[model samples]
Structures are given as structure tokens and as C-alpha cells.
Target chain A: MKEFLVISGKGGTGKTSITAGFAALAGDIVLADCDVDAANLHMLLEPVTYHTEEFIGSRKATIDPTHCSNCRLCQESCRFNAITSTEIACTVNPLSCEGCGVCSFVCPKGAITMHDHVSGHWFLSDTRYGPLVHARLGIAEENSGKLVAKVREQAQRIAQEKDVEYILVDGPPGTGCPVISSISGVDLALIVTEPTIAGLHDLERVRQLAGHFDVPVMVCINKYDLDEAYTRKIELYCQKQQIELAGRIPFDRNVVSALVRGIPAVAYAAPSTSENSAAKAIGDVWQAVRNRLLA
Target chain B: MLITIASGKGGTGKTTVAVNLALTLKELLPVVLLDCDVEEPNVHLFLQPVVNESEKVMTTVPKIDGNKCDGCGKCSEFCAFNAIAIVKGKPITFPELCHSCRGCTLVCPTGAITETPRQIGLVEKGTWSVIKTAKGTLKIGSPLAPMVVDAVRNTAPLHHGDQAVIIDASPGTSCAVVAAAKDTDFCLLVTEPTPFGLNDLTLAVELAKKLGLPHGVVINRAGLGDHSVYDYCHEADIPILMEIPFDTKYAACYARGGRLVEEFPDLSDRFLKLWDVIQHHAKRHQREEPKT
Candidate 1:
């Protein structure tokens, strides 16, 4: 199967908006939302989860007060400074803990025990587009990278079972663990960037990340007209890098309206002149990703 | 004095404020604006530092010796981060999942698990003469940002009791933020006044409290949302240092790689005073600590 992943180096770069549009155009494909930290693609997909799984992340060391010993050794051993002693009871701040387990080992009384923490939930769902796999995490919870891997696994299985020709994935922003998991073994990465300096800056960063994994990358400039001069600069950068400059999307209010309406450009405003720019942009990106990845 | 500009939510303009502040503050004091947001380091584009120096940031990971293995699976059981997993009589290493804790090494009976250093990223330091901002860039695809931030901060030229050091941190209250905020004198959390901003700001504030750092807010896009954040600040007795208006022209300048304070250097007086208020809070908090 041919796979195409859309990603932004940072948040709010129109990755989902363009991904959902491609989902409308894609046929016989399994959709995956790999942005497990803030998987808002499901908000647009509205997928009904057919299967769910629990993902246990790192564990925190808890001090048992009933152990009848208050040795401050555990407190001192923790480099994270998670454990603090007061007049009454010793406390381990969950937020401060890195789950290093150094405190648990140092406790002579064995009072400090590590307990599994529920990081988040992964789901295999059916959306209008096709079988969709996604996940959601608790606030300030770790282990999003694992959750993203699970989502991709389910999507690949669904695609194989149905003999689908395509597997569309919406990758997370940034070069974090989740992005690493998403980009690994991917056929091609469609990097959605903006025209601003920050956007171009992050584009270079994410491009470097994709380069490490040997993944083919294509760029789509969102709101290119917002800064035409910067847009030109970005074009020059892409040319210098020898990476394809897939498409340029002009600033349009309809993109926001389409998002609020909970439908993609192809579905919500198909044949509408307002979405012509974005529609062309999506098509160009899809074609570039396919040309570079598919045999 | 190292001031870290941080926000809990993504894209609340942490880099914009950091770059501009570094640009503006350089005139008042020698500044080093280290971009601790390794996941998406963007300050390099704005400042375009020359990268006079670069260094690898290494973190320790456990390496198990098969000949010395005891098949106890104790290392796996002892690992809190689940970075080590015993599958089919062999321990698998997940480097990205690893937190660089030496617990597995300490617990190995035969000393099979030993600490090994892996280069996760690089710290690039240079001077931007245009904005007069001395900056550091944390390389991408590297999970260890705090390492770069530490390297940048600990490098020579630290103007103790003199020049101020400002770090632009990654979004969210994660390990990276903790690393950046660990030794800072005070923090300035730039946030919006929206519900998402308020929720994440509360988390960041809790982080500040837990870290024992005095902090105030710079509410950007102040009029866009309700002042519940302001109300919360009042109730918590925290100071609102400054409120940047929702100006598209400012956003345009930011988009064009233009410095807001450069166009209008008068804004530096207000920012510096904001830092003064933070200093005031630090003095007050230090005074409140009981005599040891």
C-alpha cells in the first residue's frame, strides 16, 4: 500500500485541514491520527471507535506512610527532587517525578513503590472516510509516542485486511517522539509549512528530522500570500534543498468556516470558488507525495 | 540573571517574545537567548546566529551484556520508564523512551546493564549583530533539549550579577521546561486570555510554584477572551506584568522576521520594568522564607 503522512513542524499549520481534504479524495484507505498528544483529526473525522486499548505509560514512586519509617534517603537520592519531607508525612510530587525509580531502590524500608500510571487510550474506529485509528491522552501525561505507534499499527492492519490501496496518516507537529514514530518507515512525508519566518525555520528543522529517517519530503506553504516576500524566500530554500515545492495556499476565511462546519473543503465547499486554492493545494501535495513514494 | 520565556500551549508566541526581548534587551544588557524548544527550534531563523561554537548533548542509556545476563527480568521490572523490556531472553532498548536513569544499571546483579552515552543533539551558539542577540539553537530530532539548554547556560561568558540570560522554552510543562526553568531566577509565561491559554497557564503556574520560581504573566491578545485569567491572577495575588495588545501589524512584523521592539524600541522600557517586577517578587519570596 502507498502511504502519505501530513505533518507540521509546529502546531496550527493547517495539517489537519489539508489532511481531511485528502481523506475526502482518498478512496479505500485507512486513516490514522498519529498526533496522540492533541489528536484533533478525530474531531473532524468523527470516527466511531470499534476497538479500544489501554496504554500504560511510566510509573511513579509512591511513599507509603504506613511503613513506619521516615528515612530521608529516598528524598535525597531523587535527582528530580520529587520527594520532599515535611513535619508530618513525606510526599512525592507526581508532576516533578521523572519515574527514574532511584527513590524506590534507595528506600531501606521498601516503603517507596512504583505504580503504573494510565497514560492514555488508543482506539480503532470507523469514520465516514474509512477505518480510522486514533488516540487521546490525559493532560500532562507522557507516553504519547507509544500511543502513536499503536494508532499506526491498527491503521496498517485495517488497510491490509480490506486490501486498500492507500493509508493516510496525520502526523503530529514537532520533532518529538511521536513525530519520530510517525515518520519511521513512512513512504513519504507531506510537510505543511507557512510563509512566516518561524514557519520556514521550523520547516528546516522538520526537514532535517525527515532526512535522518531517509523519508521523502514535500512542502506545502499555507497562507502563502500572508507574506509574499517570505513565501518567495521559502520557494528559494526549497529549490536550493532540491525538495519539491508542492503548492501554495492563499489566505482564505473559508478554511476556518469549513473547519467550524466539521467538513473538509472537498465535501463542505466542493466546486465552490472559495476553496479552489486549498483544493488545488491539497491535490498538488497528494500528487507530489505519491510521485516520490509510490512505485 | 536568566529569564525563560515559556508558554504551556503551543504557538502562543514564545519565540516571538523571546527573539524580540533578546533583541531589545541586548541594548540594555548582554543577552543570550537560548531556544530550549528542541522539538521545534525556530529562534535560529529570526536571529540567524553565526554558530561560532557547537557541541553534542549526550544522555546516558543502559547497555546490557548478554554474557553477564541472569534472565532475571529484574532490570525490566525495576525500570519505571519501561525503557527496558525483557522479551525472549533478551533486553530490548528503547532509546527514545529512556529517561537516562541508571536504575537498571544499579539493579543488575552481574552488572550486565551499564551506562552508555548517546549523542541526542547539538547546541549552536553565535551572535546576531543585526538584533544584537546572542543566541543558541537546539537541534531537531533530538529528545534531549534540557541538555542543550544546560550546555548553553553553563558555557563561559555567564555574566553573574551583571548581564541577564533569557531562555525561550518549548511549549507545555514537560521535562524540557523543567530543565530550562531549573536554575532560573524567575520566569515570564507569555499566554493568551482564552480558555485553552488559561487552562495551560494554570499548569505552567503550578509548575512555577513547584519549582520555587517566582513568575508573572504577559497576556498576549488580552482583549480576545474573557479576563478570567486576570481574575485568577488577582485571586492568586500574582502580578500581571504586561499586556500586549492584539495587533495584526505586530503579527505581520513577526511574520516578516521584523523585530517589534526594533521598530519601536520604546517597548523595551516596559519589558525591562516587567522584569523588575519579577525581581521584586523574587526578593519578596526570598524574604518570606523562614530563617534557617
Candidate 2:
């Protein structure tokens, strides 16, 4: 099955909205919300989870008070400054620790030990489109990249088992570890960006990142009418980079109202209107993306 | 006071709030605006700071010496990031995957592994009008965002005890956000009124609570969705510091790379009021904390 990833280097550029639209258009597909830290795709798809598992992405160092010596060695050797010493005892701050195990290794009294931390939870769910694999990392948790990789792996496994046609991944924002994990090894990376200076700047960054990983990238300008000049600039940039322009979607209040109603724009069955302009644009974009993927 | 502007979800106006607040406060105080959203920083676009100096941000990765190596494979075993592998009885290092934890260098029994500096990004310093500005930009493929964030924070100009330092943090509640929000006096979490906004705002609120930082909320695009975000904040006892109405003019100004305070001078007073509220909260938090 071909895996298509929807990513935006900058946040709040409608990546999840476009991904949800693709899920509605693609028939036989498994959806994966790889934005583990802030997974919003499940909100639109409304998945019913069948299986759930705790994800222990890393370990945290904890102080065992039973063998307390208050030597302060662990506090000194820790690069993260996670260990704190007081008049009473020494303790480890889990938020500051990166689980490098340096404090545990340097503890002369053997008071520090590394324990597995359940940083997040992943689920295998059934959505209206197909099987969905998604996860939620705990608040203030690290290791989001690891959690994203796990979600992608589970989605691919379900796609192979069910003989699905595609795996549409809604990626996290930014060019950080989580975004890298989501876009790496994907068949095509479709970037959803707005027509703005920040959007253009971030598009270049994410496009360069995709090129580094040797993945083909396509661009979709969301809210293109907000600035016609900037939209033209984006078009020129895509042409210069030899990247395909999937489609341009105008800003629409119907899209926001559709999200408020907890559904994709394409799936919005308004009584008065059959299809919104944004949904129609997304339909065309999906057709072009499908043709490219098949080729 | 070091005030960090953050949001759990992307595109929620963290940069807008931060840039406006810094510009407004700079009229009354020396302000330093540090953009810690290293991976995809947008503050520079609005501020239009003319960069005066830039420094490369580097991280230390393991450099294995083949001649001194006995091929124990211990370095690979200790690497948590899977950056090292024992191939053909020799250790091969992948610098991009390395977290720069120095675990392999400490655990190498053969003493063949050494640390070397690898450039990950750049931290730039400049000024936009009266406000001193700094931003971090990660090299396109690098995954070590927190390292660049730290570099940006470290390179910021030193502020006096009374000056304001506003940081625009990256989206999401991960290590990058932690690096930006650490040791800040207050955090202004910007969000919209949508369900996605509320869901992510909840996580961001939890992060602020975990870090023991005093925080308030600034709702952007106020009329776009329901009142669930305000209700969640009310139930959670999180103060709604300010609200900016959803306006197409604001979107157009942002699209044109114009500052909010510049386009709408009235916003200056609102941002100044935001500073007062943040100070009030910070003072209240200080009074509640016990002296060591």
C-alpha cells in the first residue's frame, strides 16, 4: 500500500483538515494520526477504539529513599540537572530528565534507578473510512518521535493485513523529530500551507527536509485567496523547485463550521448546500494526488 | 520578567501575541524577544529584524576511532537513540539520529569512542526598532530542536532584573516547549475557541502546571467556534487573560507580514494590559510560594 503523509512545517495551516478530506475521498485506506502530541485527526474521523496499549518510549531515573546517602553525586554528574539535593534528601525531577541513565550510573550509593515511563497510549480504532491508528502522548511528555513511529508502524501493519489501498498519515507540525519520523519512508509528502509569509517560509523548510530524505513532495495552498500575491509567489516557488501544485483551496467559513460540527468538510452534509467550495477543491486535489501515487 | 508565549496546537497566534507584546512593552522597558520555535520560527517574518550576528548551534556526537577499537559493540548497546551500530565488528555512527546524550562515550569499554561537534542549526541576534530580537533556525534535516532552542535562549542578550523577555515557543508540549518555557516567570498560552484548540490547550495547561510556572490564557479567533475553551479554562481555574476577536483583517495583516500593533494601534493598550495581568499573576504566585 502507498503511504501518503500530510505535513505542514508551521502549525495551524489546516494539515489535519486536508488529511481528513483525503480520508473521505480515498476508499480502502487506513488513517494514522502521527501527531501524537496533538492528535486532532481523530476528532474529525470520530474513531471507536478497539485495542489500546501503553507506550513506554523511554525510562526515567527515580531515587530510592531506602538507600539514601545524600552524597549529591547524582546531582553533580547529571547533564540535565534533573537531580536535586536538599537538606532532607535528593530527588529526581522527571520533567527535566531525558532518561540518559547518567544519574543512575553515577549514584555511588545505588539509590538512583531507571524505571520505564508510560509516556503515551496508542489505539487501534475503526473509523467511517477504515481502520485508524492513533495515539496521545501524556502532557509534558517527551519522546513524541518514538510515539509517532509506533503509530505509523501499526497503521502500515493494518493496511497490509486488510489489503488496503493507502495509508494516509496526518503528520505533526514543524521539522522536528516527530515530523521527520512521519514523513520519512512515505511514498509522497503532501504539504498543506496557507498563503502567507510565514507559510511560504515554512514550506521551504519542510520541502528541503523532505528532499533530504529523498521523498517526493507536493504542495497544496490552503486559504489561497487570503493573499493573491503570496499565492502567486507560492506557485512560482513550486514551479522553481520542480514540485507539483496539487490544488489551491480558498478560505471558507463553511470549513470552520464543519470542523466545529466535528466532521470533515467533504463529509459535511449541509441541508442547503451539497458541497462546499473547499470540499470541491479538496476532491480535485485528491484526484491529482491519486493519479500521481498510481504512477 | 521572562514571559513565554506558547500553545499546544500550531497556528494559534503564539508568534502574534509574543511579537505584539514585545513591541508594546519595549516602549516602556528594555525588551528582548527570543523566538525559540527553532524548527519553524515565524517571529522573524513579522518583526523583520536585520540580523547583526549569527552563531552555529552544535551538538556533540560520538566519533569512533577504528584503530583503537576492539569492536566490543558496547557503544551501540548503550546508545538510546540507535545512532550507533556495530557493522563488520566496527562501530558506525549516524549523527542525525544521535541525541548527543554522551551515553556511548561514557559506556565505551574499549575507549575508542570520542565526542565531536556537529553543527545542527544557527542562532541569530538582531534588532527590530527598539526591541532586541533573537531566533533559532534548525538546519533542514536536523531533528535536535531542543538543542537549537537552548542555543537561542543562551545567546539572548542579558536582561536587567526589571526588563521583559518574551519568548515565542514552538507548538506542542514536548522537549522543545519545555526548553523554551523552563525558568520563565509566566507563560501566556494562546488558543482559539475551537475543540481542537481546547483539547491542545488542556495539554499545554498541564505542562505549565507540571513545570510549576504561572500561566494564563489568551484566546485568539474568539468567535470562530463554541465557548468550550472558556468553559474548560473556567473549570480548570485557568485565567482568561485576554481575547482577540476573529477578524479577517487580522488574517490579512498576518498574511502581509504586518505586526498587529502596527496595523491596529489600539492593540497596544490591550497588550500592555496583558502585561499588567501577567505581572499580577506572577506576584500572586510569588506570595503563595514558601521561602526556602
Candidate 3:
């Protein structure tokens, strides 16, 4: 089985919309939303969750007040400054803690202990298209990369159990840890970019990240008509890099309407002819992607 | 006051709101715009500032001395990130995966481990007219974005009595956003009107609440989607700070790396109004907090 990840280096470049459209077109596929920090594919897929699990991705240091004697050693030893000392006692800030266990080790009184924090929840669900695996990380939570990895692992397991041929992953934005976790080991990464300077700049960053992981990459310019020149520039960059240009989707209000309606563009009823529709372009992109995956 | 513009969802106009607000407020106050979206800094693209100073942001990682090494594997055992490995009784360090926590050096039985500076990113300070601008650019393939973000925030000039700092945070409520939002007086969350927007906005609101930071929402692309985001805000008692209508003109200007206020001069008043609302909300929230 092959996994195809749809990602954009910058946010709001239509990664989820394009991934949702591909899910609508691709058959025998399991869907995974690895953007655990902001999992939006569930809004489009409307999955009915069959299984749920708490994601204890990391540990948070906690101070036991009962053990008393505030030496403030943990606070001084913590590199993340997660421990705060006041007149009464020292406390741990969960948001700032990296769960590195340095504070607990350095505590003379053995008051600080690492406790497993339930940072998020992962779900296995059934959608209109196929089985789906997704997650929701708690607000201000770290370990999103770990949660994403868990979501993808479950998605791949379900795909294997169901004998599915592909796993379509909706990855998070940026070239950060979560994006790295989502794209790593995937068969192909489909980078959805726009025709803007920010788009081009971020595309290069994510492309470089993909190269670091030795993963093959494909490019698609969403809202290509926004700036013809930038789109041409992106085309040239992709050509020079020997990356496949899977599709160029024109800016379409229908894509927004489809999102507002909480459905994939390919599944939405287009008010006008499909000739110039962004959904049609997405379909062609999916076809190209499927051909490449199969080949 | 330090105000951070953030969104849990990407492409929600965080940078657009931040840049426009900074440009508009520079007329009334000393404004410093810190682009803390280190992984994908874009405010510079729109502002086009003339960078006057650039500094490298470095993080320390453990460098094991091979000659002094009697690798008991203690360093590898103590490393939380698994950045150290003992092969053939020799400690190998993977600086890329290191979190710079100094745990390995402390845990090493021998005096073999030493801390060394590794460049993670760069922070540049510049000016666009009267508005001071600073941004952090993470090195390609580096995963330590929060470190860079903190460096950018640290580079901001000391806040005077009348100075206002506007931080443009990266999308998502991760460590990077936390680093950017830390110590900010208020956060302005930019979102849209769709379900996805509402879902992520809720997460961002929770983040603000957890951080104990006063925050308001600015709904971008207001007409393109449902009223869910507004409904969520109203139900949650979070103030709706502003609403930027979905206009092709604004989109076109943004596509061309142009500022919203510059392209449409009429939007200046709106951004200024946004500043007023933010100040009022921040003041009221601070007053409501009981004295310790």
C-alpha cells in the first residue's frame, strides 16, 4: 500500500480542500488527518467515530506540595523555565514544560514527578469515502508531532486490515515537526501552493524538507490565476527541481462555497458547468496522482 | 502593550492583521512588529523592511569528547529526545534532534560531555518607515522553531511606556505559538467563518485561556462561510474584535504582497478601530482581575 500526503508549507493554501477532493475521487483509500493541531478534514468528511483513544503523547512535571521543603532546585535546573517559584512553593507550568525529566532528576526532595498528560485524542471513524483516522491536540499542547505519527500509524494499520491500496493523508502546514512526521515515510507528498510570494517562498521550504527525508514530491498550484507570473515561476522551479506538476487550479468561489457547505468540492453540486470549475481540476490532479502512485 | 496575532488554522490572516495593525498604529504609538512565525516568516515579505541588524540564534547541544569517553551510555539513557546513542561504547550526538535541555551533560558520569553552540536560525531587526520590524528565519530542516521564535521576541526593543508590540505568530497552538504569545498583554486570533475556522478558533481560545492571556477574535473572510465562528465567540463570551469582508480586491492585494491598508486606504480606519477595541478590551480585562 502507498501513502500520499497533501501538504502546504504555508497555511490557507487549500491543502485540506484538495485532499478532501482527492478522497472523493480515490477509491479503496483510507483517510488520515495528520494535522492534529487543527484537524479540519473531519469537517468535510463528517466521519462517525467508531473508536477513540486518549493521546498521552508527553509527560508534564508536577510538584507534590505534600512533600514540602521548597528548595527551588527544579526551577533552576529546568532549561525550559517550566518551573516557577513563589513565596509559598514552586509550581510547574504544563504548557512550558518539555517533559525532558531534567527537573525531576535534579529535584533533591524528590517532589517533582513526571505525570502523563493527556494532550489529545485520536479517533478511528467511518466516513463516506472510507475509514478515517484523525486526532485533536489539546490547546497549547506540545507533542503534536507524536500525535500525528500516532494518527498515521493507525490509518496505515486500518488500511492494511481493510486491504486498501492507498492512504490519503492531510498534513499540517509549515516545515515543522508535525509536517515532518506526516510526510516522513510516505510514498509521495503533494505540495499545494498558491501564486503568491509567500506561497513560492514556503513551497521552496517544504520542498527542501521533503528532499531531506528523501521523499518524492509533486506540486499543484491552487489559485493559479491569482498571479500568472508567480505561477510561471513556480512551474519553472518545479521543472528545475524535476518535481511533477500535478495540477494548476484556477481560483474559484465554488471552492469556498463547497467548504462553507462542509463538503468536498468534488462532491458538491456545481451551480454552473464543470468545465472551468476548481473541482474538475482537482479531479484531474487526483487522476494524475493515482497514475503516479500506481506506476 | 504586546499584542500577538495568532490562529490555530493556517492562512487565517494572522500576518495580514498583524502587519496592517502595526502600520496603522505606528501613527499613534511606537510600534514594533515581531514576526515570530519563524518556520515560515511572511510579514517581511509584505512589509519589505530594510534590515539594519541581523543576529544568529543559537542553541547549545552536547558534544561528547571521544578521547575522554568511557561511554557508560548514561548520556544516551538520560536524553529525552533520544538524540544521543552509544555505539561500540562511543557516544554519538545528533544535534538536530537535541532540545538543548543540557540533560546529557548533567547525566554524564565522566567529564566528557561539553556544551557547544549550534546555530538554529537568524533574527533580523529593521524598519519600515517608523515602525520597527523584527523577524526570525529558521534554518532549513531545523525543528527547533520555538527557540528561534523566542530569539525574535527577545530581539524586540525594550517596551517604553507608550510603545506597542505586535507579534505575528505562526499557525497552530504549539510551542512556537506559546513562545510568541508569552508575556503578551493580549492576543488577537484571526479566523474565518467556516466550521474548520470555528473548530480551530475554539482551540486557540482555549490556548489563550490556558495561558491566562486576554484575547479577542478577528473574523477574516466573513461572508464566505457560515456564522459558526461568530456564534462560538458569542456563546463563549469572547469578544468579536473585527470582521474583514471577503473581497477579491483585498485578496488580490495580499496575493501581490501588498498591505491591506496601502491598497485600500479605507481599511486604515478599520485597523485603527481594531487597535482601539483591543486596548479597551485589554484594559477592562486587566481591571477585572482581582489584585493578588
Candidate 4:
């Protein structure tokens, strides 16, 4: 199956909306929302969960006060500064811990032990369009990249079992761990960007990341009419980079209106008059992406 | 006071709020603006700071000495990240997977492992119109954003007791956001009015609460969506500090890299007022806190 990912290096650039629009158009494709930290695609698809799994992200070092050895070794050896030692005991800050086992290894008293922390939950659900694999990372939790990988693995498994032709993934913003995990091993990465300096700057960064991973990339400029000059600049950059420019979606109020109604633009827009709407532009983008995938 | 501009969802004007607020606060006091969104930092794009110093952010990965050692597999067994594996009595390392914890080096029985610095990103120190600015830029494929963020946060000048440190955090309530918002005097959670925005804003608020930060909301694109966000803030008892309505003109100006406070003189006064409200809320929050 072809793995298709919709991502924006910058957040709130209509990545999920566009991904949901593709879901509305491409029936029965395996869907994965890899933005575990702040997943929003599920709001549009309204998936009914069929399977759920607890995500044990990483191990955090904990000290047993009963052992009574406050040698301060764990506190000093922890590179993350997650441990704070008082005269009576040492405590680990869950938010600060990177889950590296150095503290446990360095403890002379063997008081520190590494325990697996359940950071989040992933779900396999049936949406109106297909089976969706999504997750919710715990508040202020670490290892979002690992959770993203879990979501993609489950989505790929479901796709393989059902013999689906495509797996559409809604990726997170920023060129960070989660975005890297989402784009890794994907067949095509459609970067959704906007017409702004921030958009262009972040697009360049994420595009470089995709290139670093040797992933084929296509560009879709959302809110292309917001700044015509920046749009032209982006088009020129894409041309210079030899990257394919898939489609340009104009600034459309219907996009937000559909979002406010908790539905995909393709589903909410009137079919008869959607020729010039954001929904239509998304359909064109989907077609372009599909053609590229098949090619 | 250290104030962080953050959002659960991206593109909700974290950088916009941070830059404008820094500019506004600079008029009253010394301000230091930190772009802690290392993954896709955009405050530099908005402020266009002249970088005075650029320092490489490094993480150490274990380098195994093959000639001096027998592969005991202890390092592999002790590694939490599974970055090292012993195959046929030879230990192999994956640098990308390594967390640079130095556990493997300590666990090696043969004393054949040493640390090597790997460049993950860079932290740039600069000045933007009297605002001391710093930003971190993670390498293209690097995933160690929190380390870069920490470096940027550390780059702030010491002895600025009266200056306001404004941190522009990346979206999502994950480790990176926490690294930016943690220990800040206050957090400004920016959001829109849509259901998606509300859903993510709730998570962001939970993060702020968990961090014990006094937070207020800044509603961007106020008229674009529904009232669910307002209801959420009201139900949660969180104050709405500012609202920038959904206007094409404002968006167009922002798209062209124009500061809202500069292009629209009225917004300057609004941001100034917003700062006063934040200071008051922070003070009241401190007063209401129970003794530790």
C-alpha cells in the first residue's frame, strides 16, 4: 500500500483539514493521525474506537526511600536534572525525566529503579471513511515520537490485513520527532504550507528534513491568496528545488465554517457550488497526490 | 518575570503574540525574547534579529573502541533507548536512537567506550530593536529539540532582574512545550474559536495547570468559529486577556511580516494593556498560592 502523509512544519496551516478532506474523498483508506500530542483529525472523522492500547513511552527512574541511601549519586549522575535530592529522599520529576537509565545504573545503593511509564493511549477506530489509528499523548509527556511510531505501525498493520491501497496519515506540525516519525518510510509527503514568511521559512526546514530522510515531497500551498508575493516566492523556491507543486488552496471561509461545524470541508460544502471553494481545491490536491502516488 | 507564549495547536499566533508583546513590553522595561520553538522557530523571521553569537548544541554519543575491548553486551543490556546492540560479539551503535545518557559508557566492563559530541542544533544570540533575542535552530533531521530549547533558555543574559523574558514556545503540549513553559511566571495560551482549537486549548491549559503556572488566554481569530472556547474558558475560570478578531486585513498584514502593533497603532495600546492585565493576574496568582 502507498503511504501518504499530510504535514506542515508550521502549525495551524490547514494540515488536518486537508487530510480530513482527503479522507472524505478517498473512501476506505487506512487513516493514521500521527500528531499524538494534539490530535485534531479525529474531531472531523469522528472515529468509533474498536481497539485501544496503552502507550508505555519510556522509563523514568524512581528511588525507594525505604532503602535509606541518599548518596546523591542519582541526582548528580542524571544528565536531565530530573532528580532532586533532599536530606531524606530523592524524587524524580516526571516532566523533566528523559527516561535514560543512567541514574539507575549509577546508584550505588541500587535504590533507583527504572519503571515504564504509560504516557498515552492509541486507538484503532472505524471512521466513516476507513479505519483510523490515532493516539493521545499524556499532558506534558515525553516520547511523542515513540507514540507516533506506534500509531503508524498499527495503521500499517490494519492496511496490510485489509489489503488497502492507501494509508493517509495526518502528521503533526514542526520538523521534530513526531513529524520525523510520521514521514519516515512514507511513500509520499505532501507538505501543507501557507503564503507567509513564517510558512515559507518552516516549509524550507521541513522540506529539508524530508529530503534528509530521502522522502519524495510535494507541496500544497494553503491560503495561497493570503499573500500573492509570498506565494510566488514559494513557487519559485519549489521550482528551484525541483519539487512538485501540487495545488494552491485559496483563503476560504468555508474551511473554518466546516471546521466549526465539526466536519470535513468536502463533506460540508455544497457539491453543486463547491467548484471554487476550498473543498474543490482540496479535491484537486488529492487528485494530484493520487496521480503522483500511482506514477 | 518570565512569560511564555504557547498554544496546543500550531498557527494560533504564538510567535505573533510573543513578538508583539515583547515589542510592547520593551517600551516599559528591558525585555529578553527567547524563541524556544527550536523545531520550527519563526520569531526570528518576524523580528529579523542580528545574530551576535551562534553556538552549537551538542549531545554526546558513545564511541566504542573495538581494539581494546571484548563485547560483553552489558552496555547493550543497560541501554534504555536500545541504541546499542551486540551482534556476534561486536557492539554496534545507532547515534540517532541514542539519548546521550552516558549509561552505556559507564556500563561497559572493558572500559572501551568514550563519549563523542554530536551536533544536534545551534543556538543564536542576537538583538532585535533593543530586545535581547535568542533562538534555537535544530538540525534538519535532529530530534533533540528540548536540548536546543534548554540551550536557548540558558543563553538569556543573567542579572536582568527587572526585565521581562518572553518565550515563544512551539505548539503541542509535549516535552518541547513543557521545556518552554515550565517554571515560567505566567503562560499565555493562544487559541482560535473552533472546536479543534478548544480541544487542544484544554490540553494546553491542563499542561499549564500541571506546571502550576498562572495562565490566561489570547483568542485569535475570534469571530471565525463558535463560542465553545469562550465557554471553556468561563467554565474553567480562566481569564481571556485579549482577542484579535478574524480580519482579512490583519491576516494579510501578518502574512507580509508586518507587526500588528506597528501597522495598527490601536493594537499597540491593546498589547500594552494586555501586559498590565498579565502582571496583575500573575501578582494575584502569587498571592493566592499556598505555602510550600
Chain A TM-score of each model, in the order shown? 0.93, 0.97, 0.97, 0.97
Q: What does DockQ give for each predicted structure?
A: 0.33, 0.76, 0.73, 0.86
- Residue B17's lDDT in candidate 3: 93
Enumerate residue pairs that collide in model 4: A11-B10
Per-candidate Cα RMSD to the true structure, in Å, reads 5.0, 1.7, 1.7, 1.3
Best by DockQ: 4
**Backbone collisions counted per model:** 0, 1, 0, 1
Instruction: Please write out the lDDT profile of model 1 over residues B1-292, one tens digit for every residue.
Output: 6678877766778887787777766777666667777777778766777767777777778888999997789888877667888889888988756777678887888888888888776666677773323333554555545556566656635554566677777776655677777657788888877554665677778768767788888888666656678888899887889888876577678787777787777777777777678778766766886324
lDDT (CA) for every model shown?
A: 0.75, 0.90, 0.89, 0.90
Top model number, TM-score:
4
Lowest lDDT sum, 10 consecutive residues, model 3 chain A, at A268-277
> Could you give candidate 2's per-residue lDDT for residues A109-161 as a string of tens digits?
88888889999999999999989999999887888989999999999899899
Q: Give a tens-digit lDDT track for model 3, residues B1-292.
A: 8899999999989999999988888888899999999889999889889999999999999988888889799889888787999988887888988999998888877788999999989999999999999999998778889989988988776754478889999999888898999777899999988877888888898889888889999999878878778778889999998889998778878887988897789999989889989999888888997335
**lDDT for each residue of candidate 1 in A1-295, tens digit (9 for 90 to 100):** 8778998787567788889888887767889988776565776677787788887766887988887277788777776667898766578988667777888887888888888878778888888988888886555555566777788888888889899988899987778767888998888888898888889878888899899889988898987877888899999999999988778887665665565556775566644565446666676766666667664
- Ranked by lDDT, top first: 4, 2, 3, 1
Mark the regions of model 2 whose C-alpha exceeds 4 Å error after superposition. Answer: A65-71, A87-89, A271-276, B156-160, B290-292
Off by over 4 Å in 3: A66-68, B87-90, B290-292
lDDT of 3 by residue, A1-295 (tens): 9999999999999999999999999878999999998889988988999899999988888998877378888888888988888787899988789988998888878888888889899999999999999999888787788899899999889888989999999999998879878988999999999988899989999999999999999999999987888899999999999999999998888887888888998888876846978999999999888888888
Q: In terms of TM-score, which candidate is stronger, 2 or 3?
A: 2
lDDT of 2: 0.90
Error of 1 at A249 (Å): 1.8
lDDT for model 1 = 0.75
